[model samples]
Every structure is written in C-alpha cells, then in structure tokens.
Target: MPSVHFAPIFQRHLPVQSLEPQGRDLSECLYALFQTYPSLKHYLLDDQNRIRQHVAVFINNQALKSRTNWNIPLNDNDQIYIMQALSGG
Candidate 1:
C-alpha cells in the first residue's frame, strides 16, 4: 500500500488528512483518492484530465514528467505528495 498526502493548503477546501490507497502508479492513486473525495478531481485536474497549472505532484520527491501517463510505477512503501506550485515575482 502506498500513501498519498496533500499539502496543508488543500485543507481549506477539503478535510486535511493522509490516505493509504492501493495503486500501482499515480493515476490509480488519484482515482482512488477521487473516489473517496470526489470534489478533489476538479481541483487537481482540468477538463482534459491534465494536472492543473498551479498544482504539482511528486512521487518520493520526484516530480511526475507526464500528466497523461500516470502509470509511473510505485513501490509498496512509496509516498506521494500533492501540493500547489509556487510562483513569485
């Protein structure tokens, strides 16, 4: 089982908590997360199912390269973190 964690900022819109879901990759993990919290789907992805510009996903500290290919394999102990991409002037 892999663990999924959302940044503190997301607590404003939904419950702030961590989840351990069974997923071979990011896509499966997200699907399971959305199933548990449907509202998150809109916040995380756009109409094309692409990751929202302001959002970033990292698997074990490595950012995902392809939004379309969420099939990036994961280990049983892997940790996935989701957070807002920061921008500054």
Candidate 2:
C-alpha cells in the first residue's frame, strides 16, 4: 500500500499532528485521512465533491486536476501529498 504524508503546514495547529495514510488509490488514501481527522473534509473538499480552491493534491510532484479523475490513480509505492496553496507578500 502507498502512504500519504501531510506537510508541516499542518503544524500551524499544535494539537493536530501530521498524518500518514495507507491505501492503493487516491480515494482510498483520502478515506484513510478522513478517518483520522473527520473534520478535514470540510477544509478540503466542497459540496460538489471537488477539491476546494485552497486545497492542493499532488502525486510524484505533479498537481491533480480532478479529485475523481484518472490522474489520481496510485500504485504500491506512490506518495500522495495534500496541502493548501501557499501565498506570500
């Protein structure tokens, strides 16, 4: 199974630590993430089942165009990343 690891941006809140999820695909991996932090869906996915504007998902250093698209497929060693877009002054 592949592992999805969250970045340190999550440390903005000390109580919530980083997450590592195991699954074979994007959906399953995200499901594992949701299981760990149920409230995370509201921050990432929207009502239409799409990733929110501020949310970003990447696999092998490439951005995902759709949450339910074919581009998100994962393999045994895939490393998925989920993060919010970074903005600076």
Candidate 3:
C-alpha cells in the first residue's frame, strides 16, 4: 500500500486527511480513493478524467510531470501528496 496525503485545503472538505490506498499505480490508487470518497473525483479530476488544471500530485516528494499520465507505478512505501496548485503574482 502507498500512503496518500491531501493538503489541508482539500482535507477540510474530505473525511480523511490521508489514506493508505491499495494499488500498483497512481490511477488505481486514485480509483480506490474515489471509491471511498466519490465526490473527490470531481475536485481532483476534470471531465476528461485527467487531473484538474489547478491540482498537483507529488510522488515521493517529487512533483508529477505528466498530468495526463496516471499510470506511474508506486511502491509500498511511496508517499503520494495531492494539493491545489498556487499561481498568480
């Protein structure tokens, strides 16, 4: 299982602040999370099933480079972080 942590902004609206999702890749892990919190899907992904433009996902403290590619493999000890991206001056 991989540990997934959500930023405080997201956590405030969700039931959990973190989770240990069961999956081999990012997509599967997100799917498992959506199963538990269906509403989260709308906040994290767009209509195309891609990560929302304002959202950011980091794996093992490294930011994900491809928002459309959710197949990134995960290790049992991996740490996944999801948050709202900050922008503007």
Tell me the TM-score of each prediction against the true structure.
0.91, 0.74, 0.94
lDDT of 2 by residue, 1-89 (tens): 66565666755432344355676668777777777776776677889767787778888788887765633567877766778877679
TM-score of 3: 0.94
Please report, as a residue range, the 10-residue window in candidate 2 with the lowest summed lDDT. Answer: 11-20
Every model's Cα RMSD, please? 1.3, 3.0, 1.0
Where does candidate 2 clash, by residue pair?
Answer: none
Better of 2 and 3 by TM-score: 3
Highest-scoring model, lDDT: 3
lDDT of 1 by residue, 1-89 (tens): 89888898888656866789778877888998889888899999999999998999998999988777788888989999999999989
RMSD score of candidate 1 (Å): 1.3
User: TM-score rank, highest first?
Assistant: 3, 1, 2
In order, the Cα lDDT scores of the candidates are 0.86, 0.69, 0.92
lDDT of the structure predicted as candidate 1 = 0.86
Candidate 3 lDDT, tens digit per residue, 1-89?
A: 89999999886458788999899999999999999888899999999998998999999999999888999999999999999998999
Stronger candidate by lDDT (2 vs 3):
3
